[model samples]
Target: MTIPSVKTILYATSLSNHTRGVFQHAIDLANVYQAKLIMLHVLKPLSDSNIMAIQSYLSEKDIQKIQNVANQETKNTMKQRLADFYQDEMAGKNLPEIEQIVVKGLSRYAIVEQANKLNADIIVMGSHNKFGRSSATTRKVIKHSGRAVFVVPTDG
Candidate 1:
């Protein structure tokens, strides 16, 4: 039997208060396994109806500009979050190499898609332990992902 090796880890975050704890777990696993870590944040795309409503009041060029700005802002926020994580958690310590990205889609699907795209060995994500149960989204991501999922429990 061949034992599975974790060479790449996909860490999906909602960027909430619980994110830091989850991220720490991801980093720890990467450190132990000497794996490359990829941090992903999913943004749900605008619904068709919402896009139509906005389009009614704005030109196509204006809409494109808005989308560009929104995407840039989200990328900026993701970078800052990573910076804060390193400063607050790692300090002067050199962590395993990490790549951060933001993509648009439904949360659960997007995470799985990114994991597949990156060919990640395992997915590390946080599950809100509310009422002694994991969050539905966490369950869905596990259900949908073909790779191993390491869920870190967090207080929401």
Candidate 2:
């Protein structure tokens, strides 16, 4: 059988400090294959208090304005951080096109959904390998993504 070449790689991250160790694998693979890297960070929905505050004190336009600014700032920070990580890990060599994404939702569902939406050739992520084999999110994505999943063992 002929093996397929990877075109796009989705690196689903938890944005945890420990996961930094495992993130290197994604950068290495992307460099080796020269594939586009989609860096994704999924955040759980904001606290009830925050949501209530938005509804109570903020108009629709005001909410949008505030949230949009927050979102853009978050995007910029994530992108810069990931870029720095890649650069530091690889010594600024063989960098790939990296797209940073942030969204609020259930991690398992959001990750698989994004992978499918991006038509990613592979999904790479870091897991603590807690529950027998991997974390809950890792297992769910492996089962539901319908794409190749690479789970890097992080220093939990």
lDDT of 2 by residue, 1-156 (tens): 977899999988766677776567887888888899998987777788988988898888998897778778778877777767856776747778888888778899999999988999999987774233458888889889888998887766
lDDT of each: 0.86, 0.81
Misplaced by over 4 Å in model 1 are 1-3, 129-133
lDDT of 1 by residue, 41-133 (tens): 888899999999999999999998987898788888878887888888899886999988888899888988889899999999888733445
Question: Global CA lDDT of candidate 1, please?
Answer: 0.86
TM-scores vs. true structure, each candidate: 0.90, 0.84
RMSD in Å for all candidates: 2.2, 2.9
Candidate 2: global Cα-lDDT?
0.81
Model number with the top lDDT: 1
